[model samples]
Target: MHEIISGLLEMTGFSIVGWETILMWMIAFILLYLGTFKEYEPLLLVPIGFGVLLANLPGAGLGIVANELVMNPDGTYMTLIDIANNYGILNFLYYALIKTGFLPPIIFMGVGALTDFGPMLRNLRLAFFGGAAQIGIFSVLLGAVLVGFTLPEAASLGIIGGADGPTAIYTTIKLAPHLLGPIAIAAYSYMALVPVIIPFVAKLLVTKDEFKIHMRKMDREYPPKHEIKHMRVVKIAFPIVLGLVVAVLVPSSAPLLGMLLFGNLIKEIGPNTARLADAASGPIMNTATIFLGLTVGATMTGEVFLNLQTIGIIVGGFLAFCLSVAGGILGVKLFNKFTKKKINPLVGATGLSAVPMASRVANELALKYDKSNHILQYCMSSNVSGVIGSAVAAGVLISFLG
Candidate 1:
């Protein structure tokens, strides 16, 4: 009777009760609640939440691991065979997809396929706001170093400011693989909260007059009917030309930029390649997202995630995001002073690479200040440029710091 009771307890995962495990479980529940009820990045958070639950279940053995015999005494390394034989499936996925640094770039290919760079092409000047926002990345890099993190670790932490999840993951995996889980979570969480964050910062920085400043419609500038053919030609050529220029300047970014350009090329090729574009942006993207989220969350076992370092990362990430917003708004203010065109400062808040979400938030704020203001197109120009800027910044960091 005693032996049976002991076996049952062990089997039920009740025999290994620990504070860390309980805390992790609670954290997982919170993620699940936010993902489900709060609708906070449900696609990513739901899978990640479930992965956290599975990892912390004690007896499941679904988290990362390494064989004792194959691990170096100095804690320096493990063999591929050791990883395959001893680690869990999640570990395999992490090593195969993330450690190789393949998944994030592939995800970028999908993003490129779905993206329409027309707005940025038309506005041109607004694209500079994207580059300005990247000041947050470098600022946080210095801050992380001051806080006692290594250069590579600082680079990884700094990337969370980009608000580009794939870029954050790519940079972190290369520079600080161990911190991937925390950084990814921080990046995605901030992105999911863009609506809350952008409004707060924009309202604080910009005046009512700036918020109400109406942008000139693209139709008035180009007369859509007159420019359709020229626009299509530019769209087809932009990615290729830009890819070549970027590759020549920054070889480290070639893989990511090449794949992105290739995907965009397929998208712009029109009807004949529509199926390819659909596959790249739809099924392929969905599958990669699920695996990526699960593997990232699985890395956050109690032993790895429940630490002071994690807290520091969370705080640092939040500060980085806020600074990015402020930088963008300040950039627009500077631009407004220099140019007679006078852009609405509110659009600057969308420079964080969160795509339509950040742009939409800015638009909503503009509407609140004045219903006549329509800056979605202008905001989108900055938003798309932010995607390019973040990727470029990641490459620069990987080249210099990695």
Candidate 2:
């Protein structure tokens, strides 16, 4: 009877019961609820939530494990052969996909394939808003330093403000691998809540008049018919030229920017490679996202995630996101002060790298203030520019801080 009871307890994962494990379970459930019921980045949150649940179920051995070098009893590093012998499947996946830093760039390739750079090209000045939005990253970096975090760790934490999940993961994995889980969670969570967060901030900083401001008419409405052909030529050239320039200026950014430009080039090369572009933006991207979410969540073991520093990261990350929104809004306000052609301040809040979502939120707010307003095209310029700005910022941080 005693033996049977013990076996049952072990099999049921009850043998490892503890407050921390219970807390982690609750956290995972909350994530699941938010993902399912609230419909917030469900594709990412669901997988990550499930991974957290799997990892916390004791004795499963499905969670990640340290490489043999770190686990060796003699306090000496081990060879690849030794590490292979000790690897868990999740650990293998994590090391293979994430630690090697292969997945994020691939994800960027998909992003590039799906992106339309036309809006940005049409409105070149708005691109600067993306750079302006990055002020939050530096602000949070200083804040993290003041609150007790190493430069590398703070850099990883500060990137949560960029609202670019893959960039945050890539930067954190390079600079501060230990903080990857918290940083990724904060980045994605804030991104999922962009609709809620951006509006609140826009309302706070932007006046009713500023919200009602409209952008100049889109080129699509009043352009020479032959302009379409010229636009295609420019689109093809833009990625190639920009890629070369960025690669020259920031070598470390080459891998990510290279993949992005390559994907864009594939998209621009015409209908012959429609299948390739579709594959990049569809199956390939979805697969990468699933693995990325799972590996990231598995890293959040109760032993590592439940700590005072985790609390600090969460707080700092939220502050960074809020400040980024404010920075973008303030940037437009500053720009308007000097120019007769004023931009809608609401468009500035879309400067984070959440893409069309941020732009949509800005448009929605504008409509609420005045139904005739349609600022999505203008906001999209800033939105896409934010993607480039975040990548560049990540490169700069890695170059200086890593």
In the range 1-402, model 2's lDDT, one tens digit per residue, is 999998988778787879988998998998899899998889888888888887787877666665443355787654445555565667767877888899999999998998999988877888999988998898999999998999999999999999888899999999998888888888888899898899888888998788877665323344323434588899999999999999999988887888888788788877988889898889999999999988888888898799998999999998889988999999999999997678898777888789889999888888898787888988999999998888899999999987
| Pairs of residues at least 3 apart in sequence or in different chains that clash in candidate 2 | none
Instruction: Tell me the TM-score of each prediction against the true structure.
Output: 0.94, 0.93
What residue runs in model 2 are displaced by over 4 Å at the alpha carbon? 7-12, 67-85, 217-229
Cα RMSD of all models vs. native, in order, equals 2.6, 2.7
Backbone clash total, candidate 1: 0
lDDT of each prediction vs. the true structure? 0.85, 0.86
Error of 2 at 285 (Å): 0.9
Give residue 103's error in model 1 in angstroms.
0.8
Q: Which pairs in model 1 have colliding backbones?
A: none
TM-score of 1: 0.94
